[model samples]
Target chain A: MRNVFGKIINTKMLYEYVSLQRLLFLLSLCLSCLYALAGFTIVATLNYIGEDIYGYLFLIFGICFLLTGISSIKINKKKSVRILIFSLILFLIVFVSTAYPSSVGLQDYGLSASLTYNMIFSIGLIIFGLIGALLSLGALFNFKPLGNQYGAYFLLVVCMLIILYPLVIIIGQVTINGAPGITWEFLTSDVRGLGESGGILPAIVGTLLLMFIMFVIAVPLGIGAAIYLEEYAGGHFMVRVIKMAVSILRGVPSIVFGLFALAFFVPIFGISFLTGGLVLSFYALPMIIRSSAEALKSIPQGLREGSLALGATKWQTIRRVVLPPSLPGIITGVVLGIGEAAGETAPLLFVSTLIIKMPPNLLGMVASLPTHLYTLFGMRGGLGDEVEVAARMQNAWSTALILLTIILILNVVALVIREKFRKEF
Target chain B: MKKKLSKEHIIQGIFLLIASFSIFIIFFIFFFLFKEAIPAFIEVGGDIFSTDFSNELGLGGAIRGSLIVTGGALLIAYPLGIGGGIFLSEVASVWIRRILKPIIEVLAGIPSVVYGFIGAIILVPFLTDSFRMISGFSLLAGGLIIGVMTLPIIISISDDSLKSVPREIKEASLALGATPWQTIKKVTFPAASSGIFAGATLGVGKALGETMAVLMVVSAITRAPDSWFDIFESGPVLTSLIAGHWGEAYGLKVNVLFAAGVFLFIIVSVMSIISEIMQYRIEKKFKGG
Candidate 1:
């Protein structure tokens, strides 16, 4: 066989003779076909298996492999041959390691065990199969089979799809399941019949109230911190310390905030809206400081200098010039922070009550959306009457839908505001 | 004019006080957690590091569980997220980037409880049916859900890092006749290593500290796994231990949960410090350039 970079061999001279690339490609293709066949057999025979779906998959893959292998034999490029060989070896190793089954019996291990084994084996096959396919397609890039740059763009499209497919699936599932539960009554009524019949009224009110309290407490403090770090502190040592502190605070787990609140705040303030909001404010404070600081920092130095040259004092320039442009950014930050505080469950678990009734006062324990959803889906252990479980599931989906919608809207508003201000400056 | 000057002074003073409040709160957290945890520290002594879950007060199992979940989550998240980030920064068009960026932000914005809810309703059942495990809740389920939860953080940070790699270096590599992939692997990735590491550190802190989703999907079994790396088995992580027991915990149990919180706080703090340093270096590099 010629070297990988060698000129293409004349097809007429090599009808019987296979180059190294063709041989390796054919071998890998055959192995993958066998793997797919095995999957088809198992999937078809399993009692709960979805028809002979895998059988058809195996047939289609087998045909593709044979066709590719035949086409590869006629080509004689050296670089294509090298990549094909490497991909084959990698695929062979993956197939061998993953498809080999253990000696555990079906009876002893149970159906789930075998099902897991098959699922993993199938996944390995599919991954290796794709890698081999992509490697073969790499030849097209070398040959310029398609227009120049098309191959590159094709790979980019594939990568983009790979990232997007999972997100699409999750969003689709949530929307389909949750949309039914969202109604006017669902939005406005108190939860009743143990979350089976009542609307999510109390949870909605509680979530909004908690967000309001958190906004009241966190915005001023966060904006102050940002102003200090950005405009006042410069490169001072204390600024560095505060920056470090903010990063650490940001990294602290939401659950830890809950634990801290339970240990420190509950004893002082008791389990109420105040405690929940305070804990959530702590959870959101670092985010607010960081985003607001970024917004403040992005203001051009020329603007500040321009104000100074106009005989305005530093405070006057900041108040009149800097703060105006940066207000939108700060509001964006605050809105995002409130969105975060609204979704947090762990921090509020100790401070917020699961009471379905409306909170009588700020200090009264209140039902918030996230904690309420957690109670319905998580605290139940998923073991109950079938009807009850189904009802709870519907409620959980609706609650999740509402929560997701609120967050996405907040994020969209923030994005729009940031982009608008960003373009203006 | 004197009164106006004093007014400005007063406003600045108020802002300074407000800015300093967070630092005070941090100190307060440390003091309070330590004060509550000291008793458990004394009780468990070296046993706190044990992986044995049989002991009611020993935190070893919880610690091990936290490590397993965090490590498992990173194993799943790092490659996919980094790859996605690379694609977003290097391969995607401006339009694609614009569309995908907000999707990531939306992913990040989705509440943790919703993630847990999805896991409880969807992922748990799938795991049970696919694996035929008696209980659907397992370390694997928790890891998968938390991995998804952390993906936005990893992708956003890594994308920023990759974007920060100077355009000239990429052009230089291309000029040298390297393939786009080759240039990315050799030049762009190396240039962005510090930032990527910072992103991974941040991801690790997130996975380690995640509570609600893991609690919802993984059975809060406060036991060491049947094996050291049994992702199929149920276990209790540090965060879950606190979340599960805190409501009903009394006396030593409460202190132990606080002790676990302190342990988690320290780990997260170290990660936060490392990421902060890396970020500072990146900022300095850009400023100098």
Candidate 2:
């Protein structure tokens, strides 16, 4: 029994257990997998080409199923296993029958029936694939050990794939569409007619300017706070309260930060670059403080003690012994904070000038990459002409690509610093 | 020597002031949100909690929408995240971990606006087509986008928690003739349950605070879903309400949006605090306290 179901099942045994019921189960599984593949192709393309590919795939699956079915009919398998596969196939087929066509208008060739039919069919196929694979694994092998182990592995792999799927799509989409819009002129010129004809020079410049101001403001205060909390505070009550507040602060929505900036900083700084920068700094502070504190905490206690033992004052110890070793960690935090601030749009929505034709000054409003994308997204339908709309979309994609590239670079740098440069205590 | 001692005192004072700046910022955020939000609470009275979007800026629908979308997001994220965590912490080898960890970080770093852009362009139309919804901007789309956005947190935190389970416990389970799968299911999972729960709470907090993606994908209509399970319907969440209405809102409307902001702040803060406490407890537990 274990030999049949185990990882090393011989072809002789594999064919030996192929009862009529087992053949039916194998055929159903193969058909459902094909349905799923067809569904995936159809949904992905939503084109006639997808249908053509589906036909070819179906033919291939059909031949494979036929071959397997012909070669594998020898002995009866467990009735219970046969019953489970039969019911599972029945359930899937039942779902396929009831899967109604989507009511959404399919003006092109009345493709609604095929579209929705394949979609739900593929969904049923996926469910059946999961159940059938498990049942087949158990029926073929000892159910107790290998089936459960591999089944759990299968589910985890699916979860990882699902998580990675969007990332792959987003990057691929942005690069394919946005790459065309990244010409030299597009990089240098100002946006014209809702990002149709012009470039994003001002937005790029403003993003950098905002990052600079944020770096100037957030780093010292964040590092200082981190230093105080990690090296100096000891067991103070205020330290604990401050830490709690920081955690809570980290979770505060960016939109609320926008609201706060609108109410507090805008009145004081008046929608200028400084206000946007300060709001971003406020958005970034918790992260920096937390990360910097983590860095400071990781430095060996002996190093600090060694400095203090040598009669180096507390401040002197931190400035020399403690700071140098943890610099990589602190710098990584700053890079991440900058990356975060660069992509922020909500906090800047109410505060940023958003559509500045020229590069921003420190005292004036800013045009950032994120807000640029937001503005372009918002204006897609409002623009009068199709050309204008399409152009705006092109620019939006380009902006997203640029923004993603910048953030990804920063992330990689941080990753490098942590992996290569960080001092291991 | 005396001058050096006084210099140290001065530096300490300076650092103290800098550290307290965080506390001050937190205070001002609360103060400013209150200052702006209180007017709506007073004028709208108990109607501030009304679920009807059309009823003079009631927040009931938005709150309910927030719950539905966030709940939906949690539904998708929780299982996948824990499973991914298990894969990372237990199943993957050290070399694989080294590669996968950074990739997950990159996933987390992808800006919310980018997620929104993709969702608005791809997922929304797909959902609209598949489900035959009004426009495709529904609780489901918002939930899906936010679910992806929140996956990294849940994955990393759960991975951390699962890894934190003392190896001895798992080893003992193995010694008792339990299979590896059984060890994970029975021993490691039970021990890491609190930490996993904390990761979930943190993920929920993040999903709750998500703005741009939810705003872009969730059709921000000011009405509760017709039924509790009606995720296909478009409804406003608090973050979306504040963001979507900010452009045209005036007078009492502005205060109402601020009130929505206050509501978001309080709820997310509560989630963060709870998760933090639970994590602290887990740390204490593992430390033999």
Candidate 3:
């Protein structure tokens, strides 16, 4: 294999083996890069031209660049290193040309129809060109077989970045906006004046209380159902029905749960802590069941069999052998369910009420964190002067931050428990 | 021993009851939603599909808006999600995958309300400013936010599917002189396509059923878009319609909202069932093969 590879590289005739198709491929790549360059710089330089034509030109350029860059994959195969280098240079030109309008210089142009069009066009050009450049560079360095692999990895990296961008921005914005509002006073006093003044102590306490109630109501049922499915039940009709019902329940929108509560729980229990907790428990049940079932599944069957073989009954084996190892996973599930319930607003919309002055009793209306944030946002413009409205907005942000913090803490705890107690058979 | 055996039977019976509670809850939810919604279905009849929101309560526009927003969301989610999945399963180092998996989990754990709040505060004004629209609340904003919300589902499930492809098959392809990308494209992706499709279907269900954020970012105007591509205009979706109007809803309006909930429930249930069947089939295929 090495001798054949060496012979092919040593051949003089192979270096001159460029066909018309290859030449056209090279020409098209060059022209496409030029088109993107002209679209980015020349189009921006001629800003007074009708913006419509610029958009059309960009649309044309974007397509041209994408098509040419994509087409080069097939055309460049087994090509000489010289051609690969040329293609790399062309891609570099396209990248540098397009990077200007889409990057740091983006703000200078301000927001305009043509500017937005130009920005979108340039960004597309940058992405395609950069991918092309990476592929060609890989080929240029004698990684011919792995060139496309490198390009694929580049795309995956881009996808990861796209997924992470919003999370970073959401957390950054919430913390920056909500940090000042989270003084000691904010955590320990009653929210007054339609949330224009005072703090969210009642809301915080109510959220904890609601989480507790939800935990108490949901955990046993979820774990019991999971145990029944995992240990007790056989492949029967009831099991299938239960599984299907759980999936259906999981897909039911939170607002639908709210409507269900309004129609059923509210009429029976009225709008109180009981109603809210019941709805949230229903909301949390599917998640808890699913996760707990997963946890139970992870316990090796041999352990259960070993216990049963030693004369332990099924329940005894589960209580002593199965439950201990799976406890962390079950706890993780319960914590996640409670975390989800804590951040839920839709299920509590009609089932809970805002109580600013005091902590809510079990059978009375209560404030939950998510609903408090919602109420504050709803009252954004109706309350008073700008300052008061701003104050309300601040409280809304703080409430959001607190809600986010609790959920994040719960999630971290869940992750830690899962990792810490993960058992390998 | 007899007493202990009977106690075991009693405990099993208790568990059976607990397991069956889900079915009971599902039945009750359906019964009550139908009880409230049937009145509107009978009274308004076919007019429940009306697009106009001025005088009568109708769901046609909301349904259309829901479809449009979900379509937009799917466009954004399908590529990024599957790509991220491919990366996690096929490309990333172990430590990178470990770090990224939790980040995606945290992304999933972020509340819908926070996503909506961020959309309303940041994305709305940005869209309004860039597009020079009358208001920033549009279906596009709703789609963008919901797309992010559904990514964790699609990514994680697709990753699982891709990872489940047998290592021996991938090695055989690599041994055959196929590039890694070729192996992924021709072997791995085809094998995992059904699972990815399942993920996409579940993502559709999620995007369709998303509320709060859509309610916050999308216009409350209970009218259909002026045209097929008119996402710049504010339009209400079904979830948003039920949530936005339930505040002052009275008499028939309340029932109409319930009717909307019924449709949302039905559509999302169908999506879930289809995805569930697909997932079950995939699992069977893998285990059997």
Candidate 4:
């Protein structure tokens, strides 16, 4: 390979080949470098058009430049070279933008777009900075492919979990702050008013009630769907359509489902936790059906045949033979459903609104973890709002943590059940 | 045939009816969304795509922003997810795999709000200063955060698909003198590609659907892209529009938000449909028991 490259470089015909390869590589590098030129144009255009060209052009162009730079990172995945190139590109943007400002003497402390320009310009720099650092490291040493792949993969998962860290922090913050504040008065009291005067007793009770009602509403129906799909229904048009619909439901935003439920079911039932439960039921039922169907499908066919051969009725076979084995998955589905139900906010938004004081009865107003977060966050700039928001955000986090733990525990149970009913090919 | 169905048939039909209702419910959601959105779209000057807040332009900026953010995040996520999934399904020692699997599972349930908070508190500032950039909030923060959010979706689905790769195929590859890695590369990936692709679609779908994290982190600007590099800039995503602007926006403005929402709904619905088809193909590939 070296001899080939060497000969290709030195020889007449092959010299062109070598130069062409080098040219392509150089062109790619240059393209990355020139990417920041867009930022320059935006800045220049801003200066040329006058400082009051307030169409958010600075921010828009800055973003475009950053994207070009990011796309340029893939130009060379060989490591160090990419980093150097990315840095050069980023420097070009910053240099060009700053130079345009200097050449035109345009300095206004980034108040042009309420600091949007500064934020966008900085984001562009960060993109380049990350690429530069990683690419530089990648350049300095010949990073082994698998080793790098492993490292990248590690970062991806850790990053993903850490993405949830904000919620967890809020949870921790809330638990430490709000959990302690949960006196009997707090528990029983209504949100009579804001700021240190009211308790969350009604809210808690309402939340628990919603959970209970949703479970009651969703679980049975969901299981029935699962059972019907697994054991009874043939591959009929209706069955297939139903299955597809369920899959789509799995995609529908929980908020939309809440809206639909509010529109379709709430009026018929009234503005109670029942409405919340009904909405959540629509949301949770699909999951239950899907998961339980999966569990049912997983049960060995031989067991069903065995039961049938022994004169067991289909119901008896499913209940006595299949149901026992599939219980774990069913339970897992239920637990997962609860976890989802507890975390949901959008669907509950219209179905349930914040009541300052708790509901007078079961049919009265309600609030859950999501609603609580929204309440705390959306209190229209109330007093001590910063600390108050922080405290409430913390409560939201703690509630989320509690919700997550419940789901995790349930998943553990499900896995154990899946293992117990382990099917072999 | 008896007029009354058999006990098994009767019970099953009931179950099926119950199971089937979920699809109807989902349909109802689409109906409601469209109903509100359509009237609202008309109410909001009837423009199919307009983000003209302060006379900005068609949600062109948002579309571009979401694509960049989601795309960049996917660029980071897909390989890591599939590769890690490959390792989980094939290479890792049992103990390591045992430990890692549970983490992926747990990671899946961590809420979007948590993910947002993390990105805002930790990732946003670290990225901003470390890069010596302008502000903590940008497309980069949203992408990185979303990349994390989408990982479990990709990993779990990819893992499931990769594991579904037949043992006989593996044995055949070994018999043909291929090493484990080579077998995984040459044989398993091809077979599992459908599942892996489906997982990728799911990941993208989830990233697109994610609101709170994106809302907390991404810049909520409404302007046209002046250059291709806007991928680094934080801007509104479709769902984020609903949450961010719903308060101040009423009348046609709210309807415009719904129109943007319609785009999101279509994207997700179409994605699920395609993936469902792909999943069916994968199952068909496995053939009869």
Candidate 5:
């Protein structure tokens, strides 16, 4: 009797574990079915039914599938998985056979001209159905109870894919569309006829010049401020206030900075590169200070004390000892700031202009890569000519590709520098 | 010795002044925005809040639009970003974190204009087809693009906060026969709540102030939404209004734009202050002060 009781308890435990796994399996199955139904409806309506009949047919089909799956799971029968898989396969076969061009039934449905459209629809349905079927099959085949360990891995992979997929698509699309337009001549000549012809030479030069001016102005001030905050200020209330101010600056919208520059700098400087650069400097300052301060804070206190003990002055220690070690970090911050300033459009919009011809000097209006792209994008209906709009779009994509490439390179280089110097401490 | 001391004092003084420059600029921004914005406020008086669409300088519609877009963006960004953050700090292996960290940083580094461009070219058409909206440029499009743009900020900051949670508490929870998820839910998340709040506030501030992406995708319709909850309709946000009008704005119109900027500045500043205080409190609590 005791042996029989032990066997019953063991069976009960096994039953509970199986039930839990079934629940999780059903959840993923439901999600996959919903996803498939949505995809199917989108493809069908967008391609054939003209978006008016969306969600009706698919909703009905999805509800039916959900009901069938739920009832099957509730029955605690081993053949439910086989039944689900069989139905999915049967549906796939029917979908393809009906959607195919050579099928004799096509004439009856009046979908002969939409052979390609039906094929696309079938593809979406097949993809989602296969995923759901496979996940369910895995759950069915496994007798041992699945644990949270596997669930954790599943969640991680899904989330990572969710984050990475969009990046991949954007980069892929930009490259495929833009690479043909990135010829040497396209990079060298000045834009003419409102970005319909010629190259982005002036925009490239102007972007470089603006970055140079911004660096010259922002780097010293940012570094000095970082130094004071890290070394001289201690934990004073004034220091706290300064930190708050920097956070506030960081939080201020880039557009407001543009407006402030328009209100303050443009009238004084008359909408020149100087005004643009000064505003960009304000934008870069908080990043520079925060990054440089973090770098300085990471330097060992023992090293500072060691230098002081050896009779080196505080300035000497900072310049010779602290600064050298923190140089990579500071440079990383500067590169990041440069990348940010280079990509900025709003701050430069009012303070700069879209000059097809290059500016004669810093005080004159200039073209920039971002502003040039903005101009090209905004050239849609205004150009009136379809060919001109197409050309402008091609140029805009190429410019975007170049801008993204430059920023990516800067980031990679910063990462490399940080890794190289990080091991030293 | 005297010469050395004098030189050091001078250097300190110069550095101090340089450090104070940011603070000076903050006040200067306030002064400039208000100097121009106040005149418009006084001129428009009660008309500033007018719901009339014909009133080009009305703040009511723009304010409501900003709230709707920002709120929608927060709704999308907070859960995904915080979940990603939790995964990064707790679940991801060191090698995976190394690969993923740079990706997140690079995503963050991508300019707002590029996001806008992508949104205009890709997201707008997709939304139009899928949702069957007459026009694709709507609050939903703006919110989505901003949400994507705000993800990196939320993830990076929240990850930092979650990483700051002491390991001992997590270990203790695990030792008490709790699962990893349970430990994270019960101990790590609560301990890191303030930091997460700070990150969320920063994300809200970002979405609130995002101009170019919204300006590029969202139609600049300066009117009240058809319904309070209708995110599918095109509307004018404050930042977009400032950006859209900045090109042709003159005299009173320009001041009104500045008034919009001033409003943005105030809202953003309050959020920033709150985030800063939250961060401070977190630090203090972690330090056992």
Candidate 6:
């Protein structure tokens, strides 16, 4: 690849020419992929053979991990023995855990696999850790060293895969579970209760309304603040203080903000969509202010001077020239804030009062998807059948996916506007 | 020519006035918490801090947990976020940039709740297996999850900062016969440090303020970590403090949760202010701001 940058290098030579970094990165990726595949195969083979065989396989790997400590110690140095001890202890625990009798008295995991999955899941984890330790020791001892970048790439990509596993599962499971329920009827209808398989239409309505109103409350205030700091209140103590305040607001936990809404806002304004919107507006502020300020700052002063030379008023230049250019940045901030607002569950908890029947105008109690999902999963023994709950869960994912999609669209729009301003100007 | 006072100026003034009132809203948040929180302080008594109460309200332990978890998350998140940002800005090919941008978008767009739900279902089990049974839901798991959550913010902002680095500096470094990495390490990174640090502090803030996911993923224990390496032990952060204790406590105890909230607010505010000041100093020093 590097050779391609030079015209002197032959095209055929490119096949033979690979950097040590790239080669090492590739090898690490393959090794990790193989290790993961092997773990998966083990799980599959165990699952296929049933409990008795699975238990024995656990016993084998368990002993392998545990016994390596002593034999290795005898053969190798004290350092190896230490590694052996750690690795031994690690696998022994996994083995002991896997060897434990099934919950609910010697049962085959059929239907509702949360417990079974959680219990059996320990084996894969042990294997991964063991491999990681082994690889680290190998790397430490390797005559041929992988450079830092290669090593970093390997670790980063592997960790990312691990993090994305659940997301992959949710995206898979939800679409499979909820695709059938996403009828026009389901999207537009109302959910009466647990038994009703009615669509989350009302929930969607409530979410959109909440997002729109939150945007309404947040954007102008946030933009004004950005303007104050960026254009008006430059290098002032109060401006600096306000900027600090916005950053602080960024870190204020949503749940506490939820509590804030409950303890403060509801008493002042009463439980309603308005309160949820207000709370969400707080969640939106920091990102909006930060991004908007960045946007305003991005507009070159030369453009302002050019406009002023044409006898444009300062306010006119700001409105016609600066605003046109900064609009994309403002929109980026707005979209990001919307994305944050859409996911908020805690604040809505306080603001929505309790379990809402439906929206009672602007001030009525309502349920958003995150809060509804929280109730379904977090609140035990509350919802309908697994199928129904699964359906609702799917709906929540779809709603989130939909929300994400909109943000994506908005982001593209912002990018276009920014790029247009950057180039066309 | 400047416009005289008119309806539009008045409207704009009103808008600015309302926006400025956001400061009052913040003050209100602090004031309300302080008002509600005094009862709890009175209940706990000022003397409580003079002696360690090994089995008391666990407030001290909760603070320790917050520091450990939030700090741990930053430690792990910082290198990846900052390094990746540098790579994207300086080293990466156009194709890599194209791929990375949307991936980050997906990452940045994913809701914290979904991240929590995923953490609860997948990561908890994965950690339980990977670590020992007892270690899965520990502070390490919480820290790791928060690290992932904070990555997009750090990456995006640091990338912005790095791209903001002057072309002249890079050319100057290369002119001195420095490697690309050397230029990045010595010139670009140092120049961009304040902005990158600001991004990091924001990541820490996100990690600290994160509730639903950390609340679900971490074991809800309120114990001070014995050592820095004892991150694998279950513990509570300040964000988790209210959720962890609010249900059990009544009256002044609930007020105690508010006090914790005040503490959280103070922490978040202080860190952000530090980052901003760092940024200002750097800009003023280097760019002649």
Worst 10 residues of 1 chain B by lDDT: B47-56
The count of residue-pair clashes in candidate 5 stands at 0
For residues B14-64, write the lDDT of model 5, one tens digit per residue.
999999999999999999999999888888888887655345468888888
Docking class of 5: acceptable
As for model 6, its CA RMSD to the true structure in angstroms is 8.2
Top candidate (lDDT): 2
State the lDDT of candidate 5 residue by residue for A179-282, as single tens digits.
99999989988788889889888888888887888789889999999999998889889799999999999999989999999889988998788888888889
Worst 10 residues of 2 chain B by lDDT: B126-135
Off by over 4 Å in 6: A1-181, A353-360, A380-425, B1-19, B46-58, B132-137, B219-235, B244-249
> Compared with the real two-chain complex, what DockQ does model 3 have?
0.56
How much is the lDDT of residue A420 in candidate 2? 71
Colliding residue pairs in candidate 6: A122-B129
lDDT of 1 by residue, A304-394 (tens): 9999899887788888988899998898988998898789999887766556665436888857889888877753545567787788778
Per residue, candidate 6 scores C-alpha lDDT tens digits across A130-186 of: 364344334332221233334444444554444344345545655554455466765
Candidate 3 deviant stretches above 4 angstroms: A1-115, A125-144, A423-425
- Sequence-dependent TM-score of model 6: 0.75
Clashes per model (N, Cα, C within 3 A): 4, 5, 0, 31, 0, 1
DockQ-derived CAPRI band for the predicted complex in model 3: medium
Q: What is the lDDT of residue B52 in candidate 3?
A: 72
Task: Please provide, for model 3 over A23-58, each residue's C-alpha lDDT reduced to its tens digit, 9 standing for 90 to 100.
Answer: 444544455445444443432232323334444444
TM-score of chain B of each: 0.93, 0.96, 0.96, 0.91, 0.97, 0.88
Candidate 2 docking: what grade?
medium
lDDT of 6 at A28: 39
Q: Model 3 residue A22 lDDT?
A: 40
Model-by-model DockQ, in order: 0.57, 0.55, 0.56, 0.22, 0.46, 0.26
Each candidate's TM vs. the true structure? 0.87, 0.89, 0.86, 0.72, 0.85, 0.75
Could you say which candidate leads in DockQ? 1
- The better-scoring model by TM-score among 1 and 2 is 2
Recovered share of real interface contacts in candidate 6: 0.28
